[model samples]
Target: MDAKTIYAQSSDIKSRTYLEYRKDMKKKAIAELEILVWLKSKLSTLYPKQKIKVSKSSGDAFLWFLRKGGVTREPDYHAMIDDKDFDIEFQYADKIDLKYFDFAISKIAKKNKKTGKREPHQDRKILYILKNNHSFAFFNPEWVLKNGKIGFVDAWRKDAYRIPRNKFIKILESDPTLKSVIEMIDVKNYILNFQHDPIGINKEKLSFLLQQIIDEQKIIKIIPNDLDSFFKVCFILDNLNKAPQNINLWLVYLLSFISNKNTTEDLSKIIYCVDFLYSKTELKYNELKSLVNKVKECFKLLKSFEQKDGSFKSSVNLSPIDETRNAVFSINLLEDLTQDLIFYYKTKEFNPITKIYQNLNFIHNTYNLIKNLSMHYYIS
Candidate 1:
């Protein structure tokens, strides 16, 4: 079946239950205020001569200032320690998208109101406070960009680097200025005492919930697999009588196993799994090489499927709507991976100039189709 038919059939399907649960989980992991309070007290002592001020910074005027500097998303808090400006953000996840670092480094050329000439925006340091297990870890964007390993993050749908908890611990323990602050506060005890939402649901309850979602949303035939294989895997996992440590990561693997073939969806699943594993484990050179090789293979396959008309031919026959949607999704994923390779990894195999022209042509054709062709069908 084509993407359009499947989407049309499942258009009314609801995912509110699962979405609500995720929303609740996010709200309960509140750490921004506590972290800011601690930083204010500790930093004042660390730098006695320097002035320190920190506060929530999402007022209209501040947001306007950030927009002028080319930032769309507002950081949770702004801190001024001595003369240095810092944008502080707290995240419940161990990893952060590399794009944030890119944004930090990029200086937008904005016209100066007084001089009427383009001038570079002032740079501010980004401080990320990430949650790991029961504690928090601090990440300096500059340090991370220099030493961090970038990988595809499934949650954010972008390539990111992990902010390991141990690194922060080491900094607190070894750094002379920070060592005193560690003595002044009980970091571990404070974090452990922080209120957390308990997982009241057991394996049986979780299985029941999963089954309900599968039925209600009619998500039985998720991507990279058909109905039979999807159900088979679900049944096998259900019989195990044990919940997978990472439910989403397990599903990615389950879907890959069911497919037993390479497709654009399979490529995405591979990247997702790789991202999950890399976050938990140390970076291995051999594994990284293997992942790059797989990326090259997928790139070659996608290029083969590209048609002369700037549209990609789907592996299975699809209607114009379905094909266009699928092709656009595949192209977006391909472009993301290609940029990661060219910019971060510095791979010479791919030509950026050639891709630039190809993407421009694809964009032009898509724009024409949406403008001229779709206009004919408009009701008003």
Candidate 2:
């Protein structure tokens, strides 16, 4: 849809327009493309002898959200070195979460419509570009199955193999050819010069920002439209090793922000802010009571939006991914906070986070239906 159309549809959300969201998406698309082009050129330059070819693969779901979004898509590009096929995924993440990688691999493994052949099997060589650090790794579902053990990943709210980063690094380093590629991929120092500084308040200004946000008198003056500034303040506070004092007032400000008018974006941010606050310190007495009540209230509201299939309703009704993703985050945080025994009596109904598993099951079932239909069509 056009910018104005998207914006009109998504006006219910916080200050950010769908046009701005699309613009951000476009910027990410361009940045990733630029990185891909640069990586291809660098690889070609570094190994003139080796038959290095990095071409854009059709599998990458760069902006499928803007398209007819229903199911999710994995982003992938192809690389052929000495005729050895490897599927490369470039992503921006602070740390490696193997469940997502596993899910992406599952998505990548698709059946050919006419031929009924499973393309890009799990055994296919997979490499990752951790964009945050500009580091590279060898990670595939085959490798994960063989090497890693199952454990719960809190972020994904699913069990993933608890593989060490060192193991992935070892694979990248063990092979002489792969090691050479890794060496060439070490563009951190080279890329840092061109990188823009992260946008947020600096460490020095954090204390001052906190004082302003938690300041009971002035904090109420901040209109809902100006909550982005409050977000920046929360960002700084969340990063701090020590918990901010006078958190009760901070929470009151957060709770006040919650209203029926608040959109999914607003709700998710407030949920995250609450989660971040609870994580930093031990709350007791009225502080604990206030926090627990807020969580329960939020959970009730979240349940109102929950679909029978586990996906949450979106105001825009454009994409399930947009609202469902935020809902997942909120649920995860709620699930985490309610883990304590003190919260059990109050939030017993909301325990275990079965919706997350249900959501995964829903997605998988959809995939299976599509696969089976394709197979039946091909056979007929």
Candidate 3:
């Protein structure tokens, strides 16, 4: 009953409580105000019909089209006016929808693995009129699916609004500034124009987040689907800031693909270990990226076997290996790649960031000491 173990137990309890609260809350009301701001403006030209019908959020045909595309939020309005029918979905980024973009791309899992039967029929949504806070953006299903990436300026803020059929091109022509924003957008500071900027990624914030994870022994308590404490801290910090940078954002993005009980421990150690390896070879960053790709594949393989139960299992071609070991290995590989990228800007170059990276020498030493503990799992 060590302190770390105790922390892990209580943290797990808290997580369960939080998850319960999360499930209890569902979107019962549509974001009508946001939707109306766009839809009412278009009624004159789009639908010339005499019949006007507006109903509350209903997960129905055409309405369900959103559901098929992975959008679970009920559309604010499913309306029929002069026999013209349409659905409008409103989204406020940095608020209700973290993965809201996913809803615009693919159809939900079409067939069940065990039954191999087609799922229920749902509407196929093509164009989505979206509001990103005060401003609005258009979503094109075909373009998103073809590209497999969402551009930040795809949803507009600080730009003029238009209901153009070719949203991307129209946006480009309508607002050059938004075009510039899209060109410049990265993983952080994307679609959501954050309201505040208290902290941006640097070594100090990274250290604070990592320490939170280590102190709480989050690595020791990770569940199959739960996010790591270090990563969770990143999200919390990110939510506070309006425009977050790529450093911590990229860290969590790459780290999240793999999961394990020791994910936190492995990542904590690997961050430093990678730095050491980088110093020896001094390889270029692009070369490091290529190496990290291999690690991602390994994680993909390990993640594939995650079962209905929490435990990892063997697939036909894959061996049944320990999930934690593979996760640690993946973490090590990513750490080796990320060491230099994280510290790209100098401490004096950016205030407070350097402080976080400072005073963390013990993490490297701790990794060295407990490196052999992994051997126990190896032997067993």
Candidate 4:
């Protein structure tokens, strides 16, 4: 189905119906629960006779089990615990905010120190369950408190894991067929390790990963695969101190490669790079101005090709060809130009050639004249 038809169909669905459907789908989705159960089962199976115990501390009633005194049983069962069995308590709530749990865990770890043991007594075993229907265990207090507190902690074990809502929804919404595709991606360890330590993904590694994925031609073929990897790469890029030169180049390349696949929001993200560059102090005005000019030219070309209203044809490529994708690309280019023009007016930079005050009035007048007209249709 085309975008318009899909959008219309979605609009026809009642909001409450859609929401209830999502809720029901989540309940039936065994992927998350399976992950939790698998982890618990693995630990027990690893040392079946070693007095290992598992418990579901979260709101989920199916898998909450507690292990104590070499016995494992349902958390509600009081038979699994004894005062001498290193009394560990399992608490489950609607949502387990890690920040609060870390604080509580830290207090417990400090108070339960063993004199003869190399590590703190509480450090030997600690676990918590969170709202996301996952369980996390801490073996060493030192490791748990590595970065001082859970909230302040960096990547756990240098692994990044989280079911980011935006990316997840984008994937499902973009390709309804990819529900299973997303499920296949391993996220259990990522979540488990993330709870203990935040993932420490650097720009270079992220860039390399993105390039590798793109080179494999996997992303372009499968929307789910590309969207997942693309967002992950973008997330890492978004958090960086600055977009690395190599990463920025890669992004530009990706943008060009996907020009034919332009969406309004996708184009917006690409335009965001322009705004980011303009906002930075690192790049000189002259450098930015030159880049902006090039973008402006691109926008002019795109404006020429755009049909009436906002939509463009999909045949346009990044080349000089008259295509709709090029036109959409121009929309972002124009957005950046407007931003720069506003900036220049605010800063009052003297025009080297015109020798006049670069005030808001002049900028507004120029923008008004050039703004609405299509770049191709407008004859200068």
Candidate 5:
């Protein structure tokens, strides 16, 4: 859809238009999902021999599988291994709990089933399977599989823990065999932290490290390398908003790395990146306001889809986590808009044509109604 069309539709101000918008959004979301599935299928066929396993299950399927296998709900496993020869004896089931596989492998050694004793096995050549485009694997701190070759693990941890970061990076760059595992590790470690700590790593240090690794690579392998990537990255980055953390360093590094040309196509990243910068208490109000204005423009450009019931679906094929997060993000944005309206009112800055006050009032009422409806769904 064109920007003008979205702007015109979104500016209708009538409830009927809002409902139509939401319905259209849902349709768009479904279309996007179909396209993504088609693309994934094509990619899979291209790599027919890859060890990655694809599952059609929704998010609940993996959890259900683990629960059926008698795995505990709490994260308790300490060791994991993917090597076929590495036979880890377990009291329960043959398959490890997917969520806790990393934790499990880190803590315990593979054992023989009959003797219940640790067994020495090949440290290299781990196996991984794909589920719904995401990949998972098992690894131990002492050893890792790289390009079908066994090698000692090298990576670093925050505390007293020692990992082979240099070796890991080297293998990741040169070894195609270990590429999937490395990517899986990066996705798990980085993507999962998007909500809690997007800027957890020091910006300068991470940039330097990433650059060094990239320099050694003949081809780069970052996924979703478009506007979608920016959204995913920014979504993770914004999760760092509520803390005492200064994400400016990280934000700067990201902006520099991604560059201006690539980011222009996706102003949402710019809006979010600006928001991160303005959020710093040290930043001047004028500077922050400029960023906020940029965000407002970006928002104006955003396509709003409405359902028949006047509710909006901000995302398509949203996972449980995404649904919860989108709701929270929408509510938070509305709250911010309310705060701005109150500020304007207090300053006697009246503008009937802009209709800021009226819009804010409508938003408040809409949000409360939706929240009440949500509660009813849960309670019923």
Candidate 6:
């Protein structure tokens, strides 16, 4: 069946996805008094203002400011006091802004040897903007507060386990949008993509390739052959189950099993029963090599399938939560596997430019994740 037909069959899905987002837009707006209160505190401490006007995507709401010859600006949150602009980002959003990552990671930069001068990084440029004749505070967001870390990505991503702790709450207390989102994550009701439009992949090609991946999963299935091994694996995964019917958990379970089998070198049945189609376990030497090559190819395919907004317009499950988030974790897993990448680089298959691009992509993707919160998780 055509995917568009399948999608069109369910009006409820689109409505449910978008309608909840509309409802949240009202709730998500930064409270006027809340910002006023924070600004008042900081203003009293550092810079004093006759009156502060909270800026928005559109022109500022202050009737006086409009009359005072102000223009619309792109700052996430900005203020005008004493006829000067203090454009700021009030670390009050869900995903850390990538601009903040641009600030932290380039803490030290590579200098130009010829010029004998310190090279400037992107964050330094932002700092320059702030420290100009008139200054502004960046209003430190949660990601910056934690010092440029991934947040709630998956069990494999370092920040996932660490973020749920209580210490991160203070960064969010000032903004109701940030505070309410944390409340939602606490209860497991945070709708990460409910507000965004679906970024479509090539439906026909994606559907075909998606079916292929599913067939591969069955062919190179990860569950152990032994009933005892199966139960042991199940016990561990059962303990880690945080959400109901979460297929992401299954992907992690398979990965855990695969991780335990990395040592298999021979054409051995790697801690598993044979898949008749693939003949041997994924961990077997030749079999693993073949699969890794296949995986490398699929990475290209997956990148092609990815939408500009970094979402695939498909699902492997019908669970209530967005499956695209799980898809992102899959991307991160594939990306984080340095072993495959090292092997690929050593094989001398890719051109010099491709190799350099592949190396730089890790940092690029990490910062990209910071800006796009759809798949990324909120820490507090």
Give the TM-score comparing model 3 with the true structure, all chains together: 0.26
Candidate 6 lDDT over 116-231, as tens digits, reads: 74443322212111111122233333344244443444323433212332333332323332343233232221222331222222123233333221122232235444433442
- Tens digits of per-residue lDDT for model 1, 1-380: 22311221122223323323322322322234334556677567666878898775642122111101233455667778877877665443343332332222222234568998544434433443333323333445556545444555666576565434444444322233433323222332222222111112222333443332222123223432443333333332323322234444444344334222444444433443333233233324544455556556655655665565545554574444334444444443344445444544556655542221133245545544434434554543
Superposed model 4: Cα runs more than 4 Å off: 1-235, 239-242, 245-270, 314-333, 344-380
lDDT of 3 by residue, 191-302 (tens): 1111011123323344343322323334323322323433343333323221123343333343444344333334433332232223334334554564355344444554
Candidate 1 global lDDT: 0.40
TM-score of each: 0.32, 0.35, 0.26, 0.24, 0.24, 0.24
Off by over 4 Å in 3: 1-12, 16-33, 48-50, 59-76, 89-103, 107-380
Error of 2 at 343 (Å): 7.5
Query: Which candidate tops TM-score?
Result: 2
Task: Give each model's whole-structure lDDT.
Answer: 0.40, 0.48, 0.33, 0.33, 0.31, 0.31
Q: Write the per-residue lDDT of candidate 5 for residues 272-372, one digit (tens) a residue.
A: 44434333434344433443444344333332322333243444553333333233333233223334333432312222111111222233333444555
For candidate 4, the 10 contiguous residues with the lowest summed lDDT are 1-10
Model 2: clashing residue pairs?
Answer: none
Best by lDDT: 2
TM-score of 1: 0.32
| Model 3 residue 281 CA deviation in Å | 62
- Give the worst 10-residue stretch by lDDT in candidate 5: 1-10
Root-mean-square deviation (CA) per prediction: 21.0, 20.9, 22.4, 23.6, 22.6, 21.2
> 223 in model 3: Cα distance from truth in Å?
32
Worst 10 residues of 2 by lDDT: 1-10
Candidate 2, residues 1-380, lDDT tens digits: the string is: 11111111111112323223433443344344545655576567546878887755542213212421232344446777787766665544344543343334243355679998545455345545554344555455556556665566776687654556656545432223333333323322222211111112133343333332233233323322345555544554344322345665666667777666665666777876776555455556677667667777777677777766645675874345445556655654455455432333343333432121222324433333334544565697
